[model samples]
Target: MTVVAEAPTFLWLEITGRCQLACGHCYADSSPLGDHGTMSAADWRAVIDAAAELGVGMVQLIGGEPTLHPGLAGLVGHALAAGLQVEIYTNLLHVTAALWKVFTLPGVRLATSYTTRPTQPAMRRSRAGRARMPGPARTSPKRSAARYRCVSA
Candidate 1:
């Protein structure tokens, strides 16, 4: 007999709506129009701490683009410290060397959408054992074919 595992309950927190790239099919309606809102760092911390106290096991950080949040690293770190497994949905366009260092924390995973160019083979190879949310990029008339490839790959 096979036992099926139950899906864990998780909080999908929206910390900001700011994004450097504005994709055409973004359901959140995020844009580079600079009209995005951000949650205060204190508020974000409070939620993480509360979730820990409530015994929540997972938290998914989302946004127009979560990395655009000024205190993204701090927020993720707080959640990790609180004993929750964290995952993020990212476009992977802005992650720099310093940014990748943020994922060194235990129980953190990234599901990046490479709508244009896929992540470096070396990076994907290293992360093979970890959970990832990967998908092709959405297409629209706004972005050139070449630019879209860059975003989706």
Candidate 2:
């Protein structure tokens, strides 16, 4: 057999078809009742091992809803323990502060987005003008955003 080389760094996985909301600008077309398929801890362990063996530097665990995965923390911990950099995209609604507490580890990054659509005119203007406006000037301030970066191990 011939030997093959691995890329230095790359995102090897994506759970693109899952999400908690089906918004107008949703890129993945996710919904609450959307397909609930998921990979188990064992499955992720296999993928991690293979990637490690190939010398892949970064291993991203993504999904329709990666936070919804039962093995999320376990898998992240596993990858970090194996010396692979980890990153995830998520809607923070399902992420508890407790969960965030556990995920803070070395070599991990969480990228999240607060998914909110400004329905009203004033709210839209405020949000649209968020770049130039200060925090207090906006109306209908959203507390919990669906997206945020989390570093959980």
Each model's lDDT comes to: 0.67, 0.61
Candidate 1's residue-wise lDDT over 39-140, tens digit each? 578888998988888778999998868877778888899999999999988877668676688876778899776433354443333432121213352334
Q: Quote the RMSD, in angstroms, for model 2.
A: 10.5
Best-matching candidate per lDDT: 1
Whole-model alpha-carbon lDDT for candidate 2:
0.61
lDDT of 2 by residue, 93-130 (tens): 66877568656777878877652345433433543334
Weakest ten-residue segment in model 2 by summed lDDT: 144-153
Model 1 lDDT, full chain set? 0.67
Taking all chains together, each candidate's TM-score versus the true structure is 0.66, 0.62
Candidate 2: residue 58 lDDT (0-100): 89
CA error at residue 114 for candidate 1, angstroms: 4.4
